[model samples]
Target: MTDIADLPFAMYDAFTDVPYSGSQAAIVLNAGQLSTENRMRIARQIGVPATSFVDRIEGTTVSLQFFSTVMELPMCGHGTLCLITRLVDLDLLPCDSDDWHNATLDLPKGKATVKYRRNTNGRIEVMLDVATATFAPAALDMDRLATLLGITPDDYSSSLPAEVASADFIHLCLPLRDLDAMNRLQPDFAGLAAFCIENGLETVAAFSTDVIAVDRHLHVRDFCPAVGVSESAAAGTTNAALAAYLFRNNLVKPEGADLFEIRAEQGLKLGRPSQITSRIMVSDGDITRLQVGGIATRVIEGKLSLPSPDSGPLSQQ
Candidate 1:
């Protein structure tokens, strides 16, 4: 059994420049002293979409783990970005040089590396070579899907089709025909939650390429009540899966070779607009890698008193 300790935690709004606009994640630093149960308890206590717990190994490399309100996740893009931004602000990640710095993150998926450099815009551009997204045929009942989305079958895009994709987590991709359909989408939380629990679905990302004028691939909205998020302004893993879907469907064709960058706009309907960029590396007609990059702003800085393992669940704290 490990002893109880008061940990330092910070809140960061990722995928948006302004705080409280993007997805918020709680980060507890130097959390190596906490056990798995303790970590989960702290995350639940935080009661956010996700919580990132980091144990600084040496220099910039560390063991980072993500926990949703329900369970510990394999990887979370927004969580990672929030932690990096917090670290950079705290001087844990040195800057001021033109050379790009690398940090090794030991995640459940694998050892993933994050590269960061102070861009010309004065923002710390952080990018992670996340899980390679893959697609699978979705055999979904149109009626059932429509019911889950709380919309009529005719509202869905007949051309884009529904498909399943995964990078860090599996996502059911629904391409809408226009922004109105995307904005008016309302998921039956109870029904979709039950379906997700039964089928192991992490999230449902709805997007439309018909909204934005130019320089953007799509306007996206995510519903993940299954994973405890009713609606997310910006999601890293979910957007990466969307990028892979676009490439697989040839919606975002390569310039000349098998490479493409997709810029996405999300959370506008929620009033917390976000800018998310994804890079796809393809080879032999297959997506080799997918990476999501964005900016994050720290909102709150303080320490949290974690509950002692002997005292019981943190809900009581």
Candidate 2:
């Protein structure tokens, strides 16, 4: 039997200063001995959209795995942010040292380097410098999207056009005319799931900039019924992709600004309002780097006791 005390884990809500506003992710700091089935079960038990397992590997590199409620993902934004925040909070990440400001994380997808910097407000933000965005022309059924979202094409006219894009994961982008159209959304989960399956997409990101609120320029809703994430608390990768979309269309002046910043608010209707702030640096019509960051609040900390290998009929709750 595995000792429960040694299997302790910590949970944090990323992207929010408040206790429960951001996306919740579980972190198993020492997951070296856990099996794949055990990890999936633990994630499902946690009931969050995603969870992260961190294992200290050779010489200052940690191996990380991100798992959704259903399965493992190649990469995830909030999970990465949550893990790095925990590391910093625990003093595991060297803060005072000059060379410690930046570190490379080995994820399932590839090696991603993150830099820690303090903003003007004295808030520490972790910038995960993502690779270039990948775009390809793909067809979408706008009517199906409207039907699933309970909106029409007329509601999105002012936003001008919709398409499919993938920064890390492929999502169908539907631009709405105003926040009112977005607020009116009540997606049919089953319908959306079927559509995603038929179209070979991951999620549908319906967004608009017409709705401006405190410290925010855009509002977005990410729906991923296919992966069992009906709605994300905050989606960092998609928001970064959105920044790329804006710059690609020349909608924003990216060069002269301190940083091209955009705030994405989500999970409001579900009573778990979360916020994600993303920035990008563009030079000579090319995005040099991308950073998505936010605060993380610790929520729960506990451990799991595994049954003995010889124990009969292991029980799960």
Candidate 3:
């Protein structure tokens, strides 16, 4: 067994009741000595879409950083949610007591407060208060995007034009006309990499309404070669951006309620079948607040050894 002192961390994948179904990442709670290079190296070694490192802070807040396999990002929803859940699990916070209801996370972009609550079924659910979304028009290179995705221009939905939106990082939203077209999408990762590099896009969110039940709506499928995520099972920030897209385009009529709730179904094609619930408040056509919540299941817990910074690549370890 590896020495506990050398391990220095525990990791978990949230929102997946089944093992290997949802996204996974490492969690470094006491990230005092770890440098950015080390973090990225570990994240790349783990091979998950995003990993989180936490530094305890004063009050109910904790400092956090998110890293993908190749780079560090401003913020990540799933990684943030997983870190908070792990905190509660480790007894780092009073998860079983009343004090567990709220905790704040200090991310690179800003402060993101998380709330924990139990549903009627007695399952733990987490809610992350995220930043408001911003929308701007960008030339939709349908030919290039479709070429990279191996789809045609006719696949996109007529009601919604492809555009870039942001809650944390920028993502291009492409609404497909049907589920078949959405399913038919087989992206050329190399092509997508080149397209995103030249176009300055971080990610592409391609979705269809065919899977959406009229009673319960959903935001699905976050594919980004830029971030090295082929398909994100559940992306809260993207959901927030979708909500803003809906409200801005008058797709959903918002009355007195500032908050809008919707279900996000993802990982179906991948056979994981995950669900995410998101809520956002918009006033005067401006998003004021956003929150994404879901249940998390602990799949695996283990430790890994790393080479010292001077030891060159981790593969040697």
The TM-scores, one per candidate, come to 0.91, 0.90, 0.88
Which tens-of-lDDT digit does each residue in 19-131 have in candidate 1?
Answer: 78988898998887677777887788888888988876678777878998888888888888888878888888887675778988887668888877777877777787777
lDDT of each prediction vs. the true structure?
Answer: 0.81, 0.74, 0.72
Which candidate would rank higher by TM-score, 2 or 3?
2
What value of lDDT does candidate 2 attain over all alpha carbons? Answer: 0.74
lDDT of 2 by residue, 1-317 (tens): 45223565788887877777778888887776667777787789878878887867454466878889888977778887777777776777756533327777898678877777555555456667665567654477777778888988678745456767776678776778888988888889999989998998887888887655666666888898888798887877777777677666666654355457767777777777777877777666577878877767788877765565445223222
Listing every candidate in turn, what is its Cα RMSD in Å to the true structure after a full C-alpha superposition? 3.0, 3.0, 3.2
lDDT of 3 by residue, 130-225 (tens): 776677776867887888888888887877778888657788877888878878888898888778778777878887656755554653677777
Judge candidate 1 against the unseen true structure and give its global Cα lDDT, from 0 to 1.
0.81
Best by TM-score: 1
Best-performing candidate as measured by lDDT: 1
Worst 10 residues of 3 by lDDT: 1-10
Output the worst ten-in-a-row residue range by lDDT, candidate 1: 308-317
Better of 1 and 2 by lDDT: 1
- Ranking of all candidate structures by their lDDT, best first: 1, 2, 3
Off by over 4 Å in 3: 1-5, 57-59, 97-100, 212-215, 253-256, 284-286, 307-317
